[model samples]
Target: MLPAIIASSRIVFADDALDIVQGDRIQAEIDALRMEIDDLRDERDEASLDATRRTEIRRLITDVVADAEMRTNRIDRPWNVIASADGDFTLEADVIMQYDWVLNSTSSEPTRYGFSLDTLWLSLGGTMFGPKWSYGVCAAVGSDGTFIPEYAYVQHQFEDGLFVQAGILSEYFSIEQAINPNEQLGTSLSFVAGQFDAGQPEGILVGRQFDQWRFWSTLSNGWGQSYIDPLENQRTGVMTRVELKPFGDWNTLYMFNPYPGLVDRGLLFGFGGSFDWGDYAAGTGRSISGDATRATADVSWQQDGVGLMAAAYYQDVPVSQTDGGRRWAAVAQGAFFPVSTWDVYARGEWGAVENGSRSDFAMATIGTSWIPAGDSRLKVVFELVRSWGSTADWSVDGDIGILSTDGDQTVFRTQLQFAF
Candidate 1:
């Protein structure tokens, strides 16, 4: 009778394990396991099996169930490659690929269309000695096929709830800048963000999270400088950002648009400032010498399928005693999922520069995105942008790819993105 019970338990274990491994429904597998366990418990007949035999059978069943659950978790998150049995150490890999097509209304600028692997990010990140110590390394290829080192940082979590990160760290000055390009609401970042982008630089960052609020400060060679730039020409500055999350968790707050059936609601308010002193070499022999101060404020809110974000930026750079000066910009954007697989969004921007000419400008953008029901990893976006007012030269501000032009300018963009 004991041998018969053992055989029955083996059959149950084998069938359940196979189902869990092959099926994508985690909750269904869990329910099946529960039903099987209840059936085994009912087989506790005193005449058929002794108490010791029943106890052994239960132990085997528990062990097999645990193994099956672990496998299910691995299948659910394939990117999280476990490095240690205790789960204190882990490794994760991520990739982002974007292909874009653009048509500019300006006669001087030819329509640009092609697969510009603008963000070929191949990154690995994980914990080291323990869960408190972590590191990340990213290598990327730019649109022009240039090898760019993105982020290489090591961070440590102190016992006192404070954290410090050092190395070539990414920017945290603006919420727009912090978001990945592939996740941006528009085809590209706004003109304001492009002008004031605090590019990745070698720096040391310190921060702490208390309840729903957190702040981070980074001291580094200032904005527009990457890790591979010339050290002698670097602009030095310190950037600080603070955030208050009045509602949901951080994960659901960062994305510009909510996924299908997103139930986690969130509200976030953030402010950041930076001051840089020194000369920034603009070109071959042209350089701007002075001190620059910048400040930005932003707010984000999301509930279910609706999302909204607004940000404002101000910068003052007194070069020499004249000739150059200040700039301010503001943007308000919103998105809503009218259908389960479709997202519609719109954005408005206004900006002005204090330089002599008519540098005031405004841009309006409307876009739509589609994500198939079968796969959320792939996204298709189409956006139309229209701008007016006198423009400054694209060289003066890193305008991403769009060229500055006189009169009203219109651009149509289509993008296909995939990530894992």
Candidate 2:
């Protein structure tokens, strides 16, 4: 009996020890589960922090890129916005001021001197919808107390090299003047320019532009300087030009061709001519009237640092109570530049006006212009003028008249101009 009792106690003790070992294993499993939960929480928090930092970095980079682009691409005011799809628009503005001094050798009129706002131009242009359609507008404040709409037009490309432009556009005769506004040699229009002005009717113009050529014609009111109807009569005219570039063998010469130069340079030769007829009546009674016709030709050559140009014009004026009148004029200009920023230029012009009832008068002008820092768009010019003929009453002396009768006299002038 004693042996059996001892065996039972041993069995009981062994069973209890086994139960204790199983309980300890359950506790260890609970501890391990808690540690796993804590690790998962730490991982989720770390991931959230990393994602937030990445998002902040992306936002910072995006803002920086947009700001830089704005600075590089914006222009002047009024027409600030162009086309905006994929950033396909542009804006621009130009301002100019000039100071001039005139010394009249025949008149003593206080030696007229003054400063003037030569031009203030604002322009906007861009493409829209696709690359095929483009538009532009240019407005200006003129020195002669006038506001001019310089250009407003839309152009469409139908195919490879053909395009059409229609609007109140520039006449072909005036295109060169518009492009090289800063390089005009004098304060007023040249003799040939005046004649062409009568021939160049300003209104609606149609133009075609190709790889190396452009042709344009216009139907406009023929009154020359007077834009008002009461002061001038209307007329009709047409103008055209053709330009060509040859020498496919000379690539080096092509780079600095004078015809196209820094702006419209190429092997450039162009022919421009115009014809016009108009009628003008004097006084309240239509009793006295005049009819006029004008024609002109322009030829130019340019290469590298040298440029040469000549223009001639003729006008026929027939009026009542006065004999038929005629006028002829010619202008020649040459320029040389050893460097890009400096240029020396000279121009000569001669003009004559005659009528059977009135004595013939002639005018001549010689001028030189200098551009010291050519890139600044600053220029200085000096002009000496002499007038002679039967009716030479056009001479001035320091803003005062010296000789009242027909004779010869000299005039001196200096002009300084800046553009931006």
Best by lDDT: 1
Error of 1 at 349 (Å): 0.8
Give the local distance difference test score of model 2.
0.54
The regions of model 2 sitting more than 4 angstroms off are 1-58, 64-87, 107-111, 143-146, 174-179, 186-189, 198-202, 210-212, 223-236, 244-269, 275-292, 317-325, 338-342, 354-368, 389-409
Q: Which pairs in model 1 have colliding backbones?
A: 222-235
Model 2 C-alpha RMSD vs. true structure (Å) is 8.1
TM-score of structure candidate 1: 0.75
Q: In angstroms, how far off is 186's CA in candidate 1?
A: 3.3
TM-score of each: 0.75, 0.64
Candidate 1 residues lying further than 4 Å off, grouped into runs, are 1-80, 86-88, 107-115, 228-235, 279-288, 319-324, 373-376, 393-401
